[model samples]
Target: MNRPAALAVLLLLAVSAGCTDTGPERTTLMVIPAGSLLYPLEDIEAAFESQHPDIDVRIEGHGSIQAIRQVTDLRREVDVVAVADASLIPDMMYRPMPEGDGNYTDWYIAFAENEVVIAYTGKSIGADEITQDNWYRILSRPDVRVGFSNPMLDACGYRALMVTALAEEYCEEPGLFEAIIGGSFDPPLQVDRTDGVAEITLPELMRPAGDKVAIRDGSIYLLSLLDAGGIDYAFEYRSVAEDHGLLWIDLPPEINLGFAEHADDYQKVHVTLGFRRFQSIGSERIGLPIVYAMTIPADAPHPDEARMFVDFVLECFQDGWPKSGTATVADKQIFR
Candidate 1:
């Protein structure tokens, strides 16, 4: 009606229009993950974003320990952390998140599963002669090289050592690890003895045998190595080997540590490490069914969106990856 009132209404309408056109910005997510899960997570990311077009998902892969460190030590910004070792979240981060989040990380969800395997090409030294029975002896050959992950860095590396130790007992051989791993490993840092156990010392470097042993951060990091013939054999997860089309020798559950029933027996062999130099995780390493863990930290950038991504991952794992014209459940077939 009046000129002043008309002008006020017009200004209000313009401001409202600006707000409506912009809407709220899409949420950006950052996921720090264990290296082994890189490829699969890439698949999950694509599918996740397709399902939630408004959200943007990005991932950074590293050793599970390093993933934790990005939050704990390095102080990098991460919305969600998914680890190969579930215990790390509780052991490392439970104390630091926001209040009411006790001394240990409480919201951990374990999904899927895997067992250890020795994957090799047909050209691998003594590949044919190697069996579940004589495998350790074959890998130990002075001429044969072995590959493993860094125990202090990756779970698979530490698991490899534990599995080798278990194989010693299961095979009824006393000096198996020494004869096999000791020859190629950088020990005295972690010494191999005639006794069933080998002493593991930090700051020690294990070298490869010419071109035989090859070490990588995550088991999946060896895919290119295997393809390029950089190394003869590697210690990897059964699921990874299957995912990459590599032939793998399945160790028995007694040694594979995939079965829950053998938890006590599997716990026999352990590896200790000086994590922060102030404390040591003594005798903590053990071979167990590989169950990856996931959680959102208290300081996440987009926590609500991160939770949604994690939920989608769990759903994909349970429902299995979608394929051409069918819904296929992995049912351990992913590792077959």
Candidate 2:
């Protein structure tokens, strides 16, 4: 064999090898979750990915309602959805969906619990003196600014209002609810006492008229503003407050939406989202134990991977929740 013949043969062999060496394609799993679960999910994603290197997990955080709507309404691709409110999974995504081909999800597992509270920084007005008993009063001051998520969009928003209504009864303050939330949003919210429960009727448009209430799309969005003094205090999840290192006032069990034992009391204050997403078929979100739920959508692109991930998350919550500022041991995590 001559040198030229040998060179041509070698080149041909290299090209053949390159064409035959097809490596495995990486599988991508898309997860849309509540902003409140961002940190914990990040940890979960890291751990899950380490154990399963072939799978690539991508996550986006939004309000729980908005998160579900991304798949059901916006037609975005998602494999898994984890929401702060478990009921949202059924109420917003269940049967009679926008697609009309049955529900977006048939079931979900409730895996974690959180509490609602008033979170603030040292720079906040009356931060040195504000206590669980005095948070509402401090919020009502003429110069103080408060922040909360949009009820039309985020669970925390409506939960904030529920906490206020509950506070009114617990403190024996007749007009406390009106003083804080009413003065914040435009066309003041109306209170309809039905069967001893104060059902708050929210306006179709959530327009924040004055600077009194800094309303954002999600609760996590307010953390930066709170830290920068753009707003004094924000209504946020207890996990969020703890994770962000903010000074928070823990509301009573009845108002915090934390204790499952107080679910009946928590149900007394509900908020109706009559926004466009509801489209006249509004979901009257009654308070319940602050449970987080996750489900692989019926139309998921990667149901198997999603199921595996959900299982991993449940196990993580059972073993790692306390360190993550989440509660799961004391019947806090009701696995469904």
Task: Summarize candidate 2's per-residue lDDT along 48-160 as a digit string, tens digits.
Answer: 66566667899998878778878887778799999988887777677655667777878888877888889999999999989977887898886888888888778888899
TM match of model 1 to true structure: 0.77
Give the worst 10-residue stretch by lDDT in candidate 2: 1-10
Candidate 1: segments with Cα more than 4 A from true spot? 1-24, 97-104, 185-203, 208-212, 217-221, 274-284, 319-336
Q: Work out the TM-score per prediction.
A: 0.77, 0.83
Error of 1 at 226 (Å): 2.9
Tell me, by lDDT, which candidate is best: 2
lDDT of 1: 0.66
Report lDDT (Cα) of residue 294, candidate 2. Answer: 89
lDDT of 1 at 65: 73
* Total clashing pairs in model 1: 6
Task: Give a tens-digit lDDT track for model 1, residues 170-266.
Answer: 8888777767664454432233443444444444454444554567765656767776776677888776776677787878788775665676766
